[model samples]
Target: MLKLENITKRYELKKKTVYAVNNVNMTFHKGEFVSILGLSGSGKTTLVSQLGGLDQPSEGRIIVNGVDTSSFKQQDWNNYRKNNIGFVFQDFHLIAHLTAKENIEIALSLSGLTPKEKSDRAEELLALMGITEQRDQLPKQLSGGQKQRVAIARALSNKPDIILADEPTGALDPDTSVQIMEILQALAENGHLVIMVTHNKYLARDYSTRIVALESGKIISNEEVRPSKQYKDDQLSTDKSSLQFFTAVKIAMNNLKIRKKSTIFSMVSLIPSMVLIFGIMNLIFNMSGYKADFKPLLGDVLGKDNLLYVTPFEDEQLESTQKTIYKEVNRLNVYNPRIEPFKNTIIEPYTDDAISDMEDIEGVDKVLRNTYFDVIIDEKPFLLMALPPKAYASYQYGVPKKHYPEDHEEGIIMSSEAAKVLLQDNHASVKHLVGTDITFNIYNYKSAAIKLPSIMEEKNVIHTKVIDIMDISTKTKLMSNYHAGYIYVSYGYAESLRERFDLDDFTLFSYSVPDPFKSVVGVEVEGGFLITGPQLVADPLRHLRIKTSLQEKYNLFQFREFDLNMRGNNYSVKHTVILNDAFNKDSLAKLKEYGHVTKSRFDAYSVESAKKTNEYINYSLLSATLIAVVVILIPTLLVCVILYVSIILRTKEIGILKSIGARNKDILNIFTMESGILALSSGIISLVVALPLIQYVRNILESEYDLQASLGSNPMDYNMLGIITAFILSVGIITMIGLLPGRKASKLQPNTLLKHE
Candidate 1:
């Protein structure tokens, strides 16, 4: 039974009050086809809406089965609509994306029925409505009569107690209207309370067992044409209504499929942001992954864990300040150490005593020193790297042992670039030139510094056989030991040359300084007095004695005005100590006291200066990563806007769902899942495209700028951590932004949304 006690639905229009449904009392029983007949705007539709629980009565009680619904909550009303009443709208109100059967199943999806049970119930209802063959067709594919039949089937799918039809045949032809009225007449005969609101008086009178006429928001007549039959009460299901998660997903996917062009456009629009985010995140990882840079090389050729890169620590001064001072000296273009007292300059060297003390440490290992100096190969300038015999024992740069120098053979290994220059053939391979002899012309600092150009002769030349050639490929390009434009030779040969030619003792002076040569070298002029002049050569032994005396007396190594640091630069000549076994943290700490030590090359020692430098680098990398995040947010905000537009477009569909018992949470779920899918798909596609792009860019940097080491020890490698982080950040940002539109959609009222254009 259903009853309305003085139900009134009022509206305030600017300054006047209008009643869509005025105070009226009515009652209806089972097996009754009640037709509320009225013209347009006579409150017949409003009365039906109140009975169906689509809109609450503004000022009265709606009693169902002797119980008042005036105090019912929103959820209770939803349950009432889902379990006690079913709606048949004039426009059919079918979701365009769903098939006829699916439209019926959607109502069942909110119930506690199993998926198979829901499917069976939907198919049975379609068969009952005589639309079984059209069950798989969408609303747009069906004719008006078939669409109305599908709508009627969906309403009957839930087996609700009351069926409310508001102008159900308003859009149908005369014959189809007769068929729909017969269906409603049958439903009333099957022990159902059927309430029909329509303006067609002829159809209403023909189908109804009782007729109620209304005018001006008030009922004018209530007449029973036939006696109401008493039928047994059928207990309706009271399960709590909810939209399943997978059902929501299906609905969202269908929506996307219907608007596939816009969905694809949205996904493509986010690709650039995704690529930028991935690339910049990788760069940040490369900048900070110093240890990982060497993992491949160390594991393949040079053993990891025990190797250490060492540089002499002169004092506690900042390394940046020291680099600045060294750069100032480099500007002078002086290559000889003696010319500017650069050997024992501001930076101190590891003395023999200090080296012996290091050897005596608790975790002492073999120490091999490397020497770097400039040499002229034939007529071309080249840098020569002299390594000790023990240092040459490892197969450096993948070169086989056949190319290594034999014991005391005085052989040299040439770089491919250097060999290309010497042979005057860029396309020729240096591998064939192995075992060939090459001549190196050493610079005579004394001869060049004393203004004697003619004396620069072949007497200073040294001949050595080429034992091997190193190709500067990207594989080993980042290692300082395998730098291009250099020659590798034994340290013993360099030591023999040093002693044979007295290379460290050659000194020079400029006339620009006070007492250019006389005060420093003590040159006596023809007047029997020491005087400053450009052309003055005293005894080599006496000049050395005076230099040593000045070094001891004033510690003049620090006081040299023109302290040129060419041959003594750390990059040119440095020592690398490799531990035979892995050492602990304490042992590494002890080694730092003797020299700058790191597990990998280019890694700074863990001192205050190095820590400060690393801090700045980390800050810069973080800023770059944040900038990437902000850049990606551009597309994320666009996704938010797109989802908002999508919500606006689906307002009617949302209202249809709500009318069929979909909760606010269900609407929110559908939108959020759509956003998540969009973001995840964009992220995956972007990463797929970005990987190859990263390698291509790295190759350009290495070939054009020689920046392999600046990026990482291995420029072609990828960081998985960076890739994962980029994906998570991009997806999370987009999904969170999408929630804004989802929340807005959830807050909308079903009545307003159903009326949305």
Candidate 2:
């Protein structure tokens, strides 16, 4: 039972006054069939709407079963609407997209019913309303009378204690109106409190047990039209469904069937967020550049393909090593990685002022000079050196700086290895080399004397040129003899007659690869045995030890330039003797067993440059493509917001549903489900559209030059499919945005819906 006392409602908009409801008192008893009659603007709707808790009065007291409803908070009222009330509207506010059965399902779905329970219950309800055959039809497919029947069925879905009807016959013809009255009358006879709001006095008089007439926002009469008798309702036997929040959501989803146009519009709006996703992908891809391709960035970069390597050798085996080198070079199809000697023996000793007129070399791109051994000066070790201003390679191993220090022309760079060696001598390498003219003339041989510096930091004897400093990783495998370390200027400068005239040619290389173990497979047949086992087991250190032990018993240094040629099973190598005294045929025959030792660490170092650039470029290109793909999120986000707004406007229908007893979660699901459908469609379209675009991109980006880049997006990639699955997740996320407003609409109480008279 509900009772209202001194109810007052007002609207104040820009100082204008509105008496939507004013000082009204009314009492509604259980099992009482009543009609609220009034003219237009008589506050008929406002009064009933307040009773249902859709709105609170400006000043009033409302009692439900002896308790004032005004004391209930919004959440408490929400529970009240969910549990106790049922509503029907004359507009037949069935969700247009949902089938008749689905419309009823939205109301009953909150009861935690099973799918089977919902299906069976919905079907039963439809049968009770004589619309079972039309249960699958949408509202638009049904006649007005059929639609109204569906609305009434939906209202009773939750099996509430009372029924509220607002203008139950407003849009019906007289004959149909009478048929609707018969339904209301029948319900009243079954002991239901049928409270209806309508303007038709004749219809009220014909069916209602009591007529409560209202005029000018006040009750004019409360009279009994017919006395009620005790009645039993077999159709009212509703099973208590244990519906939960998720169930309510499912119901809301079913209701969203009405807004097809809105759904399509929402999907269309999400394009920008998709674009953003693609943009992020682009950024990641562009930043790294190409890495896996065979193309080189620059000549020195090897910038794309080719491999270079380096290793130091014992002074004794130079001739034997040279023979193996020719054999390996002839065997491999890649760039020739020639062995270079320490620049120290080549560039050192130019200390005395013995100079010849110099001329720049032609066809040579750049020259790198570095071959300084650790040596002592005044009981302290400072690196004595020459540094190159430029070098030739496809890719740069060292990261480049945008700007260089001004004093680099007068300064030299040092490595941690060099620094530690110098610190032991009680003098800092940088300070000792700065401000003071020092001697750079020291040979690797301990027997050589220290000569004064002929080349100054600011001036060169040949020609003056800007100087730049650089540091690099170094190894002393071959430079075992005592010598100072230096890393600048050209080999030509270091090799002038005034410098030490002893060093030969060789190449040295080192690299920090992503995974050396994983990449070992690419190394094919070498002058050494072709390694065909797991990479982790290959130990270069152990092999070096074996070679070292063999060197002590044999004359390795005597054959620095001897030719060693091997193909398949047979190989020939050369050995030059230091003196005829040790050059007996027997001594040479003793070294024949180690002929396979031609493959040396020097080979690996010589090819380091070419290999590093190839790997780097291929890796860079793949990274760019991935980054470009991920950037699509930007466009996806843009589209999501626009769709969200469209969803809010489409939810006006939620009001109609709430007045008909749908729960908050029920409405949430409707909007979420609707948006999910739209999102799914959009995602599918995007993937279909993006596939060809990505293929086109793959073709365009095939090479740094006009050479074709490969399309690497694998058609059978499960991981890619997994990424596409994320679109489903994104749909749910976007659905949440639309659900918020739908939930609010569903919570609107039928009793608060002040129906316009």
Candidate 3:
């Protein structure tokens, strides 16, 4: 069945040529127990290696079943070895992790047999070798004789036409050696061409049907002492086959199980890399630029871009409005947010036609009128906004819609800053102040009627309970840029307060009326006003005060002096023109025609400043991310080193797999799968450890520091997108790192690999 013609194996040693197997002729038929007898360096093993397709002959041709192998490619040789030839080594190079049955099954795993067929075939071979009971034992647990028997059984499991044994009895005791020889003799008798290379001539004479003696690299004598049966069966054809990915996975898992400590160490080394990546992702995701310096002046009631604040433009207050600059810094925000207050009280009222014209603007959604008044709660000043029901419904912020003021509910909703001041605890949660009573002292500028200053004193008191606190879940320009604290009261309540204190009728300053002087008895002076009214006598800072009576108790008169240029009524009723989502440029320009318009935070300078601040923050975060990458690389490099060393240590196992018909792809798959598992394990463990830490930090910030104080939005909020992205990145990086060593392992040659120590 096999023929070798003029085959000469040459080698170069110390720059000199040596012929290990000289050109010689050889032929062997099927079912012949051939024993190759040779001393050390006799090339008997080299000759057998060439016949088994483990290595090619350096000279001449090897023909099998009349088919010359001179042009056989690597794949062809692999197929030849897989389907027609089986190897039994002296040392029994079975994989250490696999049991005896598993060792046999690995060979058939490449044959495209179903899992049950492979198992049954392995069981039959074990029974034939008289080692059925030891099928479940690993090579390390089996005795020397049993290991050799398992090796023979694995070789015969594929039912190859030729069995090549290289010193099959070399490592066993005498009795075990004889038993192994008897098994080989039985294989040759059962239609397998058994070829064994041995140094023991006595065993060769007793069991081998043909004894071939080799001296140097040449075969000297070939004799047949016993009759051998001629082959009657057809030669086995080469079948295209490969190791399945799941089979490789099974083998890889077995390898990891056997090297438990190494696998554990590999997984441990990758955990820190995973944790660092996840931590950096969280930090990057939480950092924001808009919350630092620039704030949005308008809330989300109407889109910020569509909400227009229209300040009445009069010639007298032109310079004041020009000088009014919106401060970007939080501490400098204490100035009047309205830009210019009511002066000697000329309320340029919006006439019916003017209101209709504003409503007629192209994209106008609605025209909202609101009033601002000065108030003091617990001796702290606040700007109270009297809002209509529509405004209350629009500014829900974080509170539910149902929590806002109902039709006639007179309670006030305060901002977090106002709540803290009222409760006298900056760190306390505003939610606790809900449903608690609060007293506000309403004040107006009486003496400084024209120019509002610190001289304005308390006039009336309004007692109410806090209904809700603004939930600043998201930071806006209004929260960051508005100087005064905010408190919201229903429109009806504010009107009642105005009437109770005569805020709109003959008061010195009327924000809603064009001229209060027409109703009250007053005369314009050089720099002030002289007004006659019974209410004026209560003025504590009246420059000049007098009382007069025209009749009995009913007709009474009082006089109080006031400065004409004093910052006029510190309060002003204003209207906001809210537009639809599709508002155009013409709409804004038309609105600006009536008064000075408030610029949004997205204006040029504000956007530029925010960009610069965010760039700096981005750079700082990038530097931290680079450091984290370096830290992560340290462990990734360790993983690569460990896998490389693992490949080196398992070279022998790699050879055994190749000899058992495993392709390079199979070896690659095994290592690749191992790396994937390691990366997945590290990612899962790191996330488990990091989630609790993030939650703990969030709780501390929310409780002790009140996250809303510094950050408008909570940065510690959990982001599953960041976590999942980090995990995928970790696995991809580690898997790529592992492929380096896997490729090295796949390129190894089985011929030289088997002989490696």
Candidate 4:
């Protein structure tokens, strides 16, 4: 069943070629009990190793069942050892952790038997070896003879074609040695090709059917002592099977269970690395300000890139219209026409035709007009702004839901500062001022020169309720120069007021016509109508007093004199345009043709500034991540080196596993799984410990210093997906670190490893 043709195994030491087994030729058939006798360094064990496929011969070819093994691929050799041969050693190389029965079962795992069949087979082998009582005991708990018996059972478990025993009884007493020889003879009788290498000639002579003696590196003598016995029918063919993945994992798990302290220590060492990675991810998320609470502060007031503010520089038509209305109203015969034409003359209100023209502009989604006026609220001056319904609905943040005004509501939304002033108490909060009434005094400036009795009747005083309050502290541009505060009335309500107060009448005199030459009126002289030339010199002092008095009342009528140059045009000098798409260079240039354009939400500078800040933060975060990896690598490399040394220390165990049909990939996977488990355990523990601690620190800062130092306290708040990704990355790194040691252990030669042990 086996053939070795001129097989020679050589080794190189200091450039010297030493022949361990030189020019050897041997052949054996089934059912032959052969003993190879030689002194130390005489190549007895080397010959047996070459026969068992443990070490490849440097010269000559080994043939098994008519197939040459020298040309066999790696998998083929693994198969040859797993199915065709079994090995026993002087030290009885059974796994230290597994019980005797489990040790035998590991070999049976390579067979295609079911788990129950393997267990039953292991029990049968233990009974046959006369160690059934010791099947549950570990190798360390068994006697030296009992351990050898377990080793023999494990070797026979697979029902291999060849049994190679190198000094199987070398460490036993005389009685145990005799019993081990009888077991080998029994294997030979059962149709196995048993080849035993030993130094004792007495046992070889008594037990073997043939004896082969070696001197130096050649076979000096070969002869048969007695006739061979007939082979049994069950053991003629080789067992062809392989270790299953599940069985390999079971063995790996058992090995780890035996070394519990070492596994726990490895897991503990990974904690700091996990904490560092998780903490960095948390900081990056918080600094980006992408959390839920901060979304309101990002200013979605106009809805992304949809809104634009347009301001016009000049409009001649509006000026000409105002002048025509002034001249025509002066010819009318009326005490007070109630509504003045000049009041509606400012930037001629955009007509339907003009609005339609603007809507046709490329990229112009929608257009809305905004108007600001100075008004007296509770006797204090404040700026009042009118907004479209969309703009009103967009002001959700910092505005209470209970105070939100409907689209057609007549009530106004007051600024927090404006509410404080109207309530006459600086300490009043916005919530307490809701539903309060405030009187707004609106004056007509165009007809101020025309004075009459009951002039106060010309002034439009409306008592409006405060429906909502908005915090505008951070919006500096929106606040304007009104440090006293501001109020927001809907555009529809403000337009209704103009009609309700008869503000369009240019022929109406303010109760009485003013004597422009002598009367004192509160208005600014620079922009107001005055008699110049001879009229100024007629009463120079009186004119100067009149101008000063007019300047005082000038501000009261300031809202009317401002030219409404946008009249008869759909586009106002200052208007907001919502776009159909995000702003780009082409769209922005097109928008600039209509007016001075600015984004309603974010300015170009702010967006650019934010981008640069985020880039810097990302670069810094990458650097920190690299540093953290290096910090983790130092200990990880140390662990790998330590594991490498530990494998070197356990060389005997590795050899024993190889002898029992464990493949290189099997050994590699076992070690890698151990490392992966350790890394995953560490990551879970660190996340559990770090999240609550971070929350505690955040709470302390908030309570003690009124600081919003934390983005969130819950796991979901701090990027849970990122945490899981980090854990998987950590396990991969740890597995890579363990690969070197696992590879080293897998490549070790069983013959060389056993000699060291």
Best by TM-score: 4
For residues 1-757, what per-residue lDDT tens digits would candidate 4 score against the true structure?
Answer: 7878999989999999999888988888889999999889899988888887778899999988788787876556667777878888888888887899988888887777888999999999989989899888988899889998898888888778888999999999999999999999988988888999998999999989999999778999998988887653333244444667776667657766766887677666777766776665555444333322223323432235566665553334434544554564464422223323433433334555665666677777677655544355655545565655644455334444454555567977887777776777767877766687767754332222222211235445677887777765422111112233457777677666645443232212222223422332332132222211111111111211222232344321111112121122212234667777544667677657665565533333333433443344456557766775786686578669667876866788777767766678767776676566566677789888767765675566557543321211222235555556566666678767878888888888776777774
lDDT of each: 0.68, 0.48, 0.67, 0.63
Q: List model 1 lDDT by residue over 1-757, tens digit each.
A: 7889999999999999999889989998889999999878889988887887778889999988877899888788788888888888889999999999999999999986899999999989998889999988999999888988998888887888799888899999999999999999999999889999988878877889999999878999999887767876655445678998788889988887888988899888988888888888877776556323233333422235656655564323324444554464344433433324443422224665776766665665755544444455655545565555644467244444555565455878877866876788878877888889778755323222221221144445677788788674422222322244457776677556544443233322223233422222233333222212322121111121233332345332121000112212222223456564545667778878876664443322223222343444567578887799689879988988889999989999998888888877888888888888888888999999999998888788667644543322443357778878988988888877878898899878877787788
Candidates' TM-scores? 0.59, 0.51, 0.61, 0.63
Predictions ranked by lDDT, top down?
1, 3, 4, 2
Candidate 4 lDDT score relative to the true structure: 0.63
Clash count, candidate 2: 139
Badly placed stretches (over 4 Å) of model 3 are 232-236, 285-604, 700-712
Tell me how far the alpha carbon of residue 425 in candidate 4 is from the true structure, in angstroms, after superposition.
37
Looking at candidate 1, what is the lDDT of residue 662? Answer: 81
Encode model 2's per-residue lDDT on 599-636: one tens digit a residue.
22122222343354344444554665555444444434
Candidate 4 worst ten-residue window by lDDT: 532-541
lDDT score of residue 702 within candidate 3? 68
lDDT of 1: 0.68
Candidate 3 per-residue C-alpha lDDT over 1-757 given as tens digits, one digit per residue, 9 for 90 to 100: 7888999889899999998899979888888999999889999988888888878878999988888999988778778887888999989998898899999998998898999999899999999888999988989999999999888888887788899999999999999999999988888888889999999999999999999989899989999979998886555467865887677888777777777898888777777667777766665555533323222222221236656655564323543543442131122322233423432233334554777888888998766544445555776556566665645466323444655666456878887766765667767887878899988765433321222211232445577888878754433321232322567776666656554543232223322223322232343443333333222222221211122121122221111111111221122223566778767888889987876555421222323333454455567568767876786688678878877888888998888878877777778888887777777777789889878887787788768755444444345667566667777877878877878898899888888889999
lDDT value, residue 434 of candidate 2: 29
Off by over 4 Å in 2: 229-652, 660-669, 688-696, 705-757
- Model 2 misses residue 33 by how many Å? 0.6
